[model samples]
Target: MIPAGRTPATVERAAEIFGKSFNYFQNQRLWEKLFPATIKAFHRAGAQRIVRLWDEEQLLALAAQRELPFDQQDIPVLPVADPQHPKPAEYQDEDLLDVVEAWEALHEAGSKITQRAWNTYVSRADDARETSAPAPDLEINGSRFWYRKTLLDWDKTRMGRGESPNAGRKKGSKDTTGPRIRPTAIARLAAAEGLLRALPNLPQAEMVKAIATTQNVTDRQALRILHEARANLGLPAPSPTEKK
Candidate 1:
């Protein structure tokens, strides 16, 4: 039931914004959230309210015995809303659980960047003449290294290069086999996934190096993203030496 002077629209808006919110498909956490939700509201910018019904006689009796401020008449029975465009109050970004998921995704991506920088690099396809070559296969003969890294501009390149290899779901998906990297390409790697350049572990370093080499840039963007992510996670920042 809405307040005496309030209109139906106001009640509808409240229900839309908060009723479903109260029923977010969470597990046992939903019950745990009530306390934190109340606290969050208290710390929030607005003077918020937390409304609930005390149907259990035991609790109601305790509250009544203690002369609680609550009144059953104050608990409004909110009506559900139409599903088109949700009301503004129903905006979930303000909710903490939403924040948790966003943080988790970012953190997971960042760690993957740290541990498998090359895989991260490979995930992003080449930009120019888009080349989707698999990580290069190196034949190391003493000092004379051998691999190929020349790239075809993706725009000029076509999928199903009769001899080229492919991965991922689409024909234009990632290159699991294409060109090998030459000695010169090493200097150019790190454009996309940043520098797994000289990473001690050869497989990852080599894969990312191939991607960066094909990408043809010196920007350490991926490494920077990972490093910053570490900082955000409360880990120490990785310096140039450490990243290298």
Candidate 2:
């Protein structure tokens, strides 16, 4: 019998599965066999309420797609009838796989979620997005922010480990790491504000000089970038009377 309650979030569902299957895998070391047994245990324990929660989550996801303002003709409109409660039908295959892989990796690593483990988690996430069917072209949603926060929390959890921060990344891959001056509009704005915070009422020439020295660029180039960044944030340009 299905439980009588609200649906849970994807992560919450994954956690439940982990709780149920953890011991089974620990004793038997059989991941493939543990899954079916866990589902059977869920029913035996009248924990099928979790399945309903999983169903609701799927419905909400589908409903979110339907609510998008943009045309979603290419999106799949799955039926919501007697939704498959959990397992391959109710939950996403990729999501389940992510939880499975992450749990096993972390478990093997003595439950220490290191940067390398995070890398594998993220690599699987990337694969999921690539292989999954196209979702609706909806407006920016909270899920993006939620996922970012989740990743950030996970990163923090793995802090202080001796793991390399750049694990699993190939050398010379300077996209997100390494030294580079690829400042975005947000970064530039932040720099301008930070400069003002550090040196209140700083002169334009001094600001330019500081940036130039830090960035190893000519004063003129730094001044140009500074002016543009200040303009972007609507901050007033530095006064000419300050030190050059």
Candidate 3:
């Protein structure tokens, strides 16, 4: 019998049946390519946690086809419980754009910012009051995503002011007279921000250790970077008595 509850193991089993890596489905964008309708319906239905059994059946049927580059139309349509009732208005926006898509959109709009820089901007959006960057519109399974139109609108507003689509100090703003941060330091802080977002529930001390191991820095240095990352992301710093 098919599993009654959708869990990580269920996803893994489905991935195996679909002949795709588990991570492929774990990433929302990649998974949407295969089940766009299901995703749309899920989002439309207020994104509740319940998983429909028909979705699993659709996966199995698609796998049976053994077709490479399957057409979305070939997938079974999601049946509505009440055909007489009209569905809620469709989401007017385009498919939710992940960080990668946002980065690409900025580049296409003549911004010269690197992907890392774009990521840093996104990481700091909630705290970086100096810039007008928009915070993520939604998060799915720990990954943050923004609406395509929201990003394009932000880009257009920036471009209209003759500013680069990338975030920076406003024109005629006072330059920082304090000691400049090293490029390596900035890179490490950004990397730490990414790790913190990925493993948000990890203990502070353990997170520092993980960063130290991955970044090849001393624990003290890693702790410092993690603290700075937390500040940038508007997350609270660990208590002084907290072990590091």
TM-scores for all candidates: the values are 0.17, 0.23, 0.34
Residue 121 deviation, candidate 1, in Å? 14
Superposed model 3: Cα runs more than 4 Å off: 1-93, 158-244
Q: Lowest lDDT 10-mer window, candidate 1?
A: 142-151
How much lDDT does each candidate structure score?
A: 0.30, 0.41, 0.59
Give per-candidate clash totals. 16, 2, 0
Model 2 lDDT tens row, 58-167: 33443345345434322323232222233324432222212233343234435555455544544464334322212212112121111222333343454332234323
Ranking by TM-score: 3, 2, 1
lDDT measured at residue 168 in model 1 versus the true structure, 0 to 100 = 32
What overall lDDT, based on C-alpha atoms, would model 1 receive against the true structure? 0.30
lDDT of 3 at 182: 54
Full-model lDDT, candidate 2 = 0.41
Give candidate 3's error at residue 181 in angstroms: 17
Using lDDT as the measure, name the better of candidate 2 and candidate 3: 3
Stretches of candidate 1 off by over 4 Å are: 1-69, 72-89, 92-176, 179-244
- Candidate 3's residue-wise lDDT over 1-244, tens digit each? 1111211224566667767787876565344465534322322232234332224555666667645555533555434332122233422244354566567656765776678766666767476543536777766556555765677676655442224434345456477575445555777889999988998878888888888998789999998899889999999876667653
